[model samples]
Target: MNINIKFPDNSVHQFPRNTTPLQIAENISSGLARDVITASVNGKLVDVNYPIQEDARIELFKFDSLPGKEIYWHSTAHLMAQAVKDLFPEVQVTIGPAIENGFYYDFDKDVPFTDEDLEKIETRMKELARENLEYKRREVSREEAIEIFRKMKENYKIEILEEIPPGEKISIYSQGNFTDLCRGPHIIHTGKIKAIKLLKISGAYWRGDARNKMLQRIYGISFPTSKELNQYLVDLEEAKKRDHRKIGKDLDLYSISDDIGAGLVLWHPNGAMIRNVVERYWIDKHLEADYKIVYTPHIGKSELWDTSGHLGFYRESMYSPMLVDEQEYYVKPMNCPFHIAIYQSQKRSYKELPLKYAEMGTVYRYEHSGALHGLMRVRGFTVDDAHIICTPEQLYDEVEKTLVFSLDMLRDFGFRDFKIYLATMPEKAVGERQNWDQATESLREALHKNKIAYEMDEGGGAFYGPKIDIKVKDSLNRLWQCSTIQFDFNLPQRFNMEYIAPDNQPHRPFMVHRALLGSVERFFGTLIEYHSGNFPLWLCPIQVQILPISENYEDYARSVYAEIRQHGIRAEIDLKSEKIGYKIREAEVRKIPYMFIVGQKEKEEGTVSVRRHTAGDLGSFLLQDIVKRLKEEILTKK
Candidate 1:
């Protein structure tokens, strides 16, 4: 029998029914066969040896593709699990899956796996890979699966099979002496994995449910070539060096204390200063863009959230309501409801359409203690949030302005590359079909109008609306989720928001909720890692640290510092007991963009020796000339 297979590029090929992706790759080229790691048939990741029995779209994935890397790492996880079973037969494997950078496997065991155990597992995995074991998939009835695991004393596997819905197909992957329950898209054989490393081990909740049993999760990574694995290890080291938590501690920027509880951040003086600059820039930009600055209370009546549907959808993350005079009040998790109330204070007309309200809104969420990490994932943070209430005719312009504004803001802060995703409506979304269609079209048109290309993230929108999320890429090519523009239809109807049309009839206004920097805390964390603590002149808390060689020259250093400070530069005088080189090195470590060294000669000549944080000594300059150069760097607007 013949089956038509449509390639990712829409080209169709006829192949015999039950053909495998590996066979297809071999037909293309021996080199492609060697490089191909996985395949997706009609959007489902299946084993390279899995048979395609019917007409479908086939996407052959290499290591360069995201899905291909996922498959590679996932197979490595299975190998790790096999190794663990071989060494510790008492342990039971529950689940193993691939993540962003690698893969981890959850094991139900009496004892936790240690670093030595990880080393042994890595060795066993290498031995298994060298055996060139073929990954064979077998399908059995659910009852038969349970019986087989029960006979083997694999209670965990039996439990998993019992929990799965009846009538669903049960498939298991077998390699040599090890067999496990899995739905996989593994490479042709274990030998395809040439390089592997066990990274770490941690405790995880079984099935990710805290109420369930705990499991030991072993994390690992793999590559087709040792060179690629070596490069990955190097990148991992660089990422560790750039971790914001480490930099925060070294630079005295922010801290998370055990006494203060988890998910709460305490910003030091320097961090506060940087935050002030960021907020000031945000306010100035919004004002220049004709947005009205607004403020809202941190807490509001519980009824407000109930009306906005947040109480129903977001109750788990929200704090319990406070009772005052028998009425419950809740801390704000979002600023949207309050903004809507303000808009309702008075009647609006079509002429006042596209009313842009911008705010630095602080919100609180009940983040889990274990999940909290530095400023990147926190419980409390301020959002540089805004809402544009516009007529249908104004939707395009509003979205376009938002895109341009966000891009310009990122570029100004040293982020030049970004990944964009246009998310359409989800199956569970509210609003008329026509409304959703029109809103998605408006967002699409706006992106095209600005000449910004974006990929479609189908059904990846919020429950109330479609949206576009922009992930900014840093100097190290790390992607951080940032600016977002969400189009909401349910809010206007739920809040009864309206504007009088030209014909004097009240009509529903389109609501656009957007945030350029997303959360200020997350942005700060990304910025610290993006530049590795070397912030630009504009955002640097202490742009210039004046180092006086001795106590005698402190006065001259103070004078230069005051002169720069008066000109709106973040300048400071360091008069600590330290040598000139030591002080300079300290300032460089702190990531101060500029350092001015003051000595007897500099004081007598009214000159300051300048050094850049990243660049070495830039020679001496008159105090005024040094200020001028620093000012130019700060004022280089996007």
Candidate 2:
């Protein structure tokens, strides 16, 4: 029998019924066969060695592609697990999975892994890789799989096996003497991983449950070539230098205190200034764009959350409710419910079909102590939210407008490169099929109309509806998720939202929950790292520093500062007894956008010598001329 294989470009070719992906690649071209890492058979990821049994859509992946990299990293994770188990006889492995940039394996060990232990384990990995052991897979009945794990004393694997859906095939992979229970499509051989680097070690709770025993997690990355690994290491170093935690502390921007508890940020004066500037501009632009600004309270009754279905589905992430007037009140994990409450407070008509309610609301969620990062992952942070209530007839236009506005906002903040994703409805989802189709189509058409390229995330949407996710690429070439325009059919239905139509009939309002620079703290952190702490002129907390060459020019500096201040520049004057070079150096250290050096020559000439950050010694310019230029840059966000 013959089977038809469809390529990603919609071309089909005939092959034997049991021909493997590798064989098909070989039949096509030798070069393709050499580079092919794995193939997606009928939308399911499968090994290159797996036989093609029928007509299917096949997309072959190489090492550089995202899917291929994930598979490659996952294979390396299994290799690492093997090495660790070989070195530590008593240690039991839980799970090892691939993550962004690398892979991590959790081990049920008595103590945490040390540097010396990592060195020995990594050495063993290299030896095993050199042996070129082919990873062989075998299918077994569920009971037999359980028996295998039980004999190996891998209790974690057995627990994972118990959770596997009934009728799903249970498979085990073995390379050398180590075997693991995984529904895998791993690399052909250990030799494929040519370069390896064990990044770090950390403790993770088993299955991410705090009540479970903490396990030692070893994080690492591998590459097909040594050059790629070296470059990644260099990028890692650069990332450390640009780390927001270090930059925030050095600049005295913000602090997360042990006293105030983890995950709550204390924004210092500098950080607060940055936030104020962003909020002011945000409000101004929102008003210009016709978004109605609204304020919602920090806490809401448990009944409110219950009605919103959050207490049922999202209780784990939410903090315990406090007693308020004999009722349970929760620190809101989101602002959508309150926005819905506002809409419910009054009856509406089609004339108010597209009402956009915007808010800069602070909400709190319970993040485990281990999960809290500097500002990126926090318990409490302000979100720039906008909920649009519109009729089905207006959904398409509203989504398009929101997309344009979101893109514009991100660009204004100096983000040029973007990674967009159009995520469609998931398997277990709410809403009618017609509504889901229309909502997904609206998002798709908006991207197409804007000529924006985006990847399709199949079945990756929220249970409520489809969404468009925007991730901005930072200077380090790392993608950070920022803007989102998510449709919510579930919320409107749960809240019984309604707006009268022209025919005098009540209809469910289509709800869109959107945000740009989603979290203020996270966005601020990204901004800090994006510019490497040297913020752009408009966004910089301290825009200008008036450094006098000496106390003789202090009066001149003060005058320059006042003029700049009048022009609405964030200016400051240095009056400390320091050398001219020292003051200039200090100004640079502060990452001030501009430094006006006033001396006798410049003071008499009615000018200040300019020293711009990133470009040293911009020469002399008239105070009025410089001020005009500064204002333009700030206004234009240059």
Candidate 3:
């Protein structure tokens, strides 16, 4: 029998049934056959060697594609596991999976894997790849799978086998002397992986549960060419230099102290100044956008959480309740409940529909110590949260406006590149199907209407509703999820929220929860990395630094500082008797945007030598003219 296969270019071809995707690629061109790593048969990803059984749409994936990379890294993980097992007979493989950048395999071993062991593993992986081992898959019954693992004395594999449903197909893949249980569409052969590198090794809990035994996890990356691998390594090194934790400490922006508790950030004067500027700008923007800002308590009664369904659905991340006058009060994990309360305060009418309430609400959440990192993941942080309660007719417009506002704000902060994701309802979600569909459509329309390109994340939305998640690319080209515009049909219904309609009947108003900067702490962390400590003039804590060449020029430096400060520029004088070069170097290290070097010539001429950090000297300018240029640059946020 012959089958019709539709290519991505809309070309249709007739081929015999059971013809593999690789054969199709070969028929097209030998170059394509060599380049194709995987294929999607009727939208389901499969190996390039997968047989074409019926009429289908076949999309071949190259090494550069996301699915292709995932398959490549996943196969690399198996290769790594095989190498580890070959080196250490006693080591047991628990689980291994592909991450965003690479892959990691966790091992249940007596001793931790060392750096020396990593070198051995990489050597073994390369040797194994050169062997050109074929990956063959076989399906087995659940009992057969259990028996196979039991014979191998792999307890982790047996435990995994027990979780498989009775009638489900249990597939295992074998390559060379190594065989493992996997549901895979792996590469046809190990030779496909050419260049391999073992990045690092770390400790991880079995299945991410701290209660489980700790396992040694080895991270690695592989590429078809050595050039790609080398480039990736270069990016990794640059990423370390831009690490927010290191920059945060170097700049004295923020700190996480053991005494204050982990995952809790203490912003120093420098960080606080930046935060103040961001807050002021945020408030001013919200006001201009016709959003009424509000303040809510950090703790709310247990009854309030119950009404919001947080006690039922989101209790795990919430802190334990405290008893106050026999009533339990819980630290707020979200500001939605309080916003709902405000809506319910008065009997709202249709005239009051589309009410927008914004807040820099601080909320607490219980984060695992192992999961916490600098400001990105914290126990307590302020969310740039807002709720827009509007009529169903106003939902689309509000969502579109919210998206536009979010992009404008992010752009103002120097984020030019953005990737938007429209996340739809998940399998376990609240709200009616109609409400979910309406919410998802609103987000889709918003992105489409704005001519913004986005990817659809099916079943990746919050339990309450669908959302538009905007991930901004930093200076390192790494994506960070910052803004979210979400709909909340569950909360409004749970709280029995209603408004008087035009027909004089009570109706449920649609609620939208938006966080332009998801969290102030996380956004600040991203900004630190994005700017690499050299902030824009308008956002810099100290816009200008006055340096005196010697003790004789101290008076002139002080005068210069005073003059700049009078013009509302954040100016500081380095009054210490340090050498001019040393003072200038210190100012540059501090990432001060401008340094006014005052010396004998400047003191006599009543002019200052201006030096821009990272740009070197800009010659000498009169104090008044320099102030005008500085003000203009700062105002323009250049």
Candidate 4:
């Protein structure tokens, strides 16, 4: 019998039952077969050699796609592992996995890998790749797999095997006398990987538990061609120059202290000013959109969390509860439950069905110290959170509005490229199946109606419900998840939240947890890198710098600064008695958008010489005229 295979273009063809993707690709065309990196059947990723035994929807990927890149990176990781084993016979590989940028492999070796070692390993990997070694998979019983690892003295592999449930099919892949346990549909041959680079080495606790032995993890990147690899290396260097931690310190924007704790951030004055501007703009926009801005306490009764299911599902990330008045209290990890409590404070009706509550609430979470980085990953941060409680009839409209608002908000910040995802219900989810299906369909329809393209994340939704996640692309073309519009089928039912409907019967209201700019701290860090510290006029903390040609023009500079301040420009005057050139350089270093230079010629004329950051000096203009231009630019958000 033949199986009906549906291609991505919605075209279907009959194929032999045991025919593989490789065979199908060859039958279609030799060019497609050569270009195809991998294929997915019914949303499940599989290698080109995977047999198509049943009717399925097939998607073929090339090197450019995300899934294809991940598969390629993972295969390179195995090649690197093979190279290490050949170079250092004593080194024992534990686990290697592909990440966002590249791949890393952990090894239980006594000596840490050095720079010289990385170079040697990379050279060996390239040599092996050119050998065209074929990858062969062998399935074995769990007991037999454990025995194989035991004979090889691979303790980590044995530990992994012991944890697997009984009767689960186990397999090992081998290429050129090197074998390791894996659940793989790897590329057919090593020759497919064209370029490889071993980046660096770091220590990682086995299984992420500090108590376990520290293993040396080697990170690397690979590409199908040498040119792409070279481009990625160039971008990698540029990323280092724009590192947020270095920029933060240079501009005195923020700091993370060991004394205060790892993941908590201290926002310096400059950073706070930026945050204040963002918050004010956020409030004004929400108010214009008819969102009621409200405040909630940082801590809530433990019973509230228990009712919201946070205690059960999200306890690992939440802080330990403290006893207050003989009852437990938890620092809120979220603000939605508190918003629900406020709704419960008064009886609501169908007329008030679509209630939008917005807040700039700070919440605490527990992140491993090792994972903490500058601003991006923090324990304590404010969330630009909002929730919309609406009736079933209004669900799709509300979702669409939230999506549009999110796009507008991001656009105002100069983000142009967006990648949207519609995540459906996971296997382990709460709420009725019918409700989940309806909510997922509503989000899908909203995306379609708005003409927004999105990918379906088959099971990427929270356990509570489905969601729409929007990721903004930065200057380096890196995607950052900033906006989320999630349905909450669990909360309304858990809290018995309802609004009286037109039929005079109480009905559970649909709740959408919407966050644009996800976390203030993370978004701020992203902005620092996105703008390269040269923020737009409206968001710049110090919009203008007043520089005097000499001490003789100090008074003139002060007057210019004062006049600009009166016009609501964020201005600073150079009072260090430094040369005008030095002051201008200092202003440029700080990335101020504009600079006003004063001299005797300009002071006598009541005019100031202007300079734009990263640009040369402009001709002199009357101070009032310049102020008007600045105000207009700021008002227009240029």
Candidate 5:
């Protein structure tokens, strides 16, 4: 029988029913077949060797594609696992999956993998890759699979097989002497992984459950060329230098103490000052934009959460309830419920439509202790949250305005490059289909009207509604998810939010949840890394450090500092009994933007020597002139 194959460009070609994707590629061009790693056969990812038995849509993937890279990395992971098994015969593999940047495999082993072990494993992986072993897949009956694993004494595989329903096909992939249970669309052979690097090793709980046994996880990445791998290594080193935790400590910005508990940040005076400045700027902009700022409590009653459906769908991330006056009160994981409560507090009118409520609300959520990072993943953080309550007619305009505002704010914060994602409803989403469709269409229309290009994330939205997620590119070219504007069709219907219409009837108001900066702590962390501790003059905690050459010049330095402070520049005098060079070095180490040096010549001439942190001396200038320049920069937020 002949089958029709549709290409991505909508071109169709006739082929035999048993023709594989590889054969189709080869018929087109040998180069395409050589580069093809995987394919989407009728929207289902499958190996190129899989037969096409019917007319279907086919999209072949090369290493340049995301799915192709995933397949390459996953196949490299299996190769690494094979090497580990070769080196350690007793280790049992549980699961190995591809992540955002790389892949990791968890092993059930008594002995933990060390740095030396990774080197050996990488060596072995290279040796195995040179052999160009083929990854062959076989489908077996559940009983046969269980018997195979049982005979091999791979208890983890046996346990996994028990969960599989009877009469279902269990796929097993084998390469050389290594075999694993997987649903794979891997690369044809291991030789494609030309450059490999085992990044690191860490302990991870089996299945991410605290109650489960801890397993050793080895993370690794691969590239098709040595040049790409080398460039990646360079980027990795730069990332370490820009790591927020290290920069935070070096700058004395924030600290996380064991006594204070993990995932909780204690911002020192410097960090607090930066945060205060950011908050003031945020508030001023919000007020200018006609946002009604409000404060909400950290906890809400269980009944309130029940009505909001947070207890039903989002309870896992929430803390356990606390008893207050015989009633259970839980710490809020989101500010939406409180905002809803405010909306429901009194009768609203359509004339008051598009009521923008903004808040820097702090909320607490439970994160796994192991999953917690420096400031990115925290238990408690403040969100620059806002809710826009509007009528159906106003939804599109409101969303568009929010999108423009969000992009403007991000650009102001030095994020010029962005990738926006329009996430559609998930399978488990709430609200009626009509509501979801309307909300999704509004978001799509906003993006289209604004001429903003965005990628669609199919079935990747929140349970409530569709959303627009903005990811900003940092200095290192790394993407960080920051802004989100989500429509909530479930909340208004659940709370029965009503506003008086022109016809004297109650109508539901559309609720939109927006967080342009996401969590303040996370944003601050990103800011630190983006600038590599060299914050702009406006955001720097210590804008100017006055360094006196000797104790005799302290008075002049103090006067210079006072004068700078008068111009609203954050300035401090270095009074420590240290040499001039030492003080200058210390100022540079602290990442102070400017340094005002005072000495006999400067004091006598009524001028201060100006030195930038990284840019040497900037000649001498009158204290007033220096202050004027600094004020101009600060006012301009340069």
Candidate 6:
């Protein structure tokens, strides 16, 4: 018997029945056979050794491809399981899967894994990889799976098997003496895992349920070659160097203390100064763009969430309600509800169709302890949120204008490269079919008209609407999600919002919720990493630091700094008794944009030696000249 295997290019190949994809690859080319790690059959990833029984479309995945990475990392996870079994034979492996960053394996070990154990396991993993043992996949009956794991005394595997649906064919992957309950698409052999390292160990609840047993999760990353591994390690080092948590502390920008509790950021004076400048600029730009600024309360009645349908879907991220005068109140997790309430406050007319309301609204959400990382993921943060209420005919133009506004603002913040994604209706959305179609089409047309290239995510939107998310690329080539525009039809109908038409008929209005700097805290953190804390003169908390030659020149330095400060420059006087060189170094370490050295010779002539933060020896200049140059740099938007 023969089977037809369709290639991605629509070409079909006749292969003998039960022929494996690996065998077919070998027939085509030995190079491809060696490189192919996995195969996608009819859009589902499967092991290369899996038998082909029916006609199906196939795509061979290499190490660089997404499916290839999945298989490689999945194979590496098997390697990790092997090492863990060897090191702790008493431990039971429940599950291991490949994640975005790498692979993680959950273990029911008697002892909690520590950094030392991770190092030991990593060393053993290298030894196992050296063996180059073949990874074999086998189909087993549910009863057989239970018996095998039972004989091995792996109760975790038994528990997982019991929950599997009846009559389901169970699969077991065995590499060396370690076997796991998994549906695998692993590499052909352990030799394919050339470069591997265990990164971290953390405690995770079984199946992510808080009530389940705590399992030790060992995270690791792997590559096919040493060069790629080395590059990854170098990138990790660079990320650490650019970590905002470290830079924020070194510069005294912000701090979080145990007394203040977790996920609550206490912005110091310096950080507040930078926030003030950014907020002021943001307000001016929105006003110039014909946006009306509105203020919303930090907390609202819990019933409001019910009307917005957030309570039904987004309750996990929301704070618990507080009883207030026989009513429940919630600290807002999103500003959309209040903005919608304002739109419903008055009877709207078609002449006011495209009413834009913008706000720097602060919101609070209960981010998990494990998920919170410095300012990037926080419990309390302000959103540069806005909403546009328009008629259906105005949908395309409104979306286009919002995209233009967001992209231009991001460019002004020095983010030039961006990737856009149009996320369609979700599986759990609540909107009429026609409304969903119209909103999705309008968003697509807006992107197309603006000449912005974007990829479509089949079902990545909220439970109420479709959306477009803009991910900005930073200096290190990492993408940070910064902007989002969502088209919501459910919210307007849920809140019973409407606007009067030209012909005196009331009808539902389309709602567009958008945020350029999605979360102010996260955006600030990304900016810190993108520029490595060397913010532009305008955004820098301390734009200039005045370093005097000694204590004798403190008065002169204060005068120079005062004059600059009077001109709206953020200048600080270093009046410490430290040497001039020491003060200059401190200024550089603080990432101050400019340093002005005021000494006896410079004080008499009303001149100061200017030194840039990164570029040294900017030489002597009149006080007024330096001020003019600094002001120009600040005034220039981009």
After superposition, the stretches of candidate 4 with alpha carbons farther than 4 Å from their true spots are 1-79, 89-116, 126-196, 202-217, 222-231, 426-429, 473-480
Poorest stretch of ten by lDDT in candidate 3? 472-481
- Evaluated against the true structure, the overall lDDT of model 6 is 0.88
* Candidate 2 wrongly placed segments (more than 4 Å): 1-79, 90-102, 105-112, 127-195, 202-216, 223-231, 320-328, 421-466, 472-481
Off by over 4 Å in 5: 1-75, 88-117, 129-195, 202-217, 222-231, 426-429, 456-460, 472-480
User: Which candidate leads in lDDT?
Assistant: 3
Query: Which consecutive 10 residues in model 6 have the weakest lDDT in total?
Result: 472-481
Each model's total of backbone clashes: 0, 0, 0, 0, 0, 0
* Native-to-model Cα distance after best TM-score fit, residue 576 in candidate 3, in Å: 1.7
RMSD of 2: 5.6
Model 6 Cα lDDT, one tens digit per residue, 273-363: 8888889999999999888999999999988998888888889999999989989999998898888888888999999979999999999
Query: Model 2, 103-126: lDDT tens per residue?
Result: 999999997789999999999999
Question: What is the clash count of model 2?
Answer: 0
Candidate 6, pairs of clashing residues: none
Give the per-residue lDDT of model 5 (tens digit) for 1-638: 89999999999999999899899999989999988999999999998899999999999999889999899999999999999999998999888998878799999889899899999999999999999999999999999999988877888888889998998999999998999888898888888789999999999998888899999999999998899899989988887888889999999999999998888999999999999998998999899888999999999899999988889888889999999999999999999989988988999999998899999999998998877878888999999999999999998989999999999887777766778999998887678889788889989999999999999989878889899999765444566678999999899989999999999999999989999998999889888887899988889899989999999998888888777777788888999899999999999999999998999999999999999989999999988888889888888777
lDDT of 1: 0.88
**Candidate 2 global TM-score:** 0.78
| Superposition error at 48 for model 1 (Å) | 9.6
Clashing pairs in 1: none
Any runs in candidate 6 off by more than 4 Å, and if so which? 1-72, 90-101, 108-112, 134-175, 178-195, 204-215, 223-235, 302-306, 310-330, 368-370, 416-434, 448-460, 471-481, 604-606
| Whole-model Cα lDDT of every candidate shown, in order | 0.88, 0.90, 0.91, 0.89, 0.90, 0.88
Q: Clashing residue pairs in candidate 2, if any?
A: none
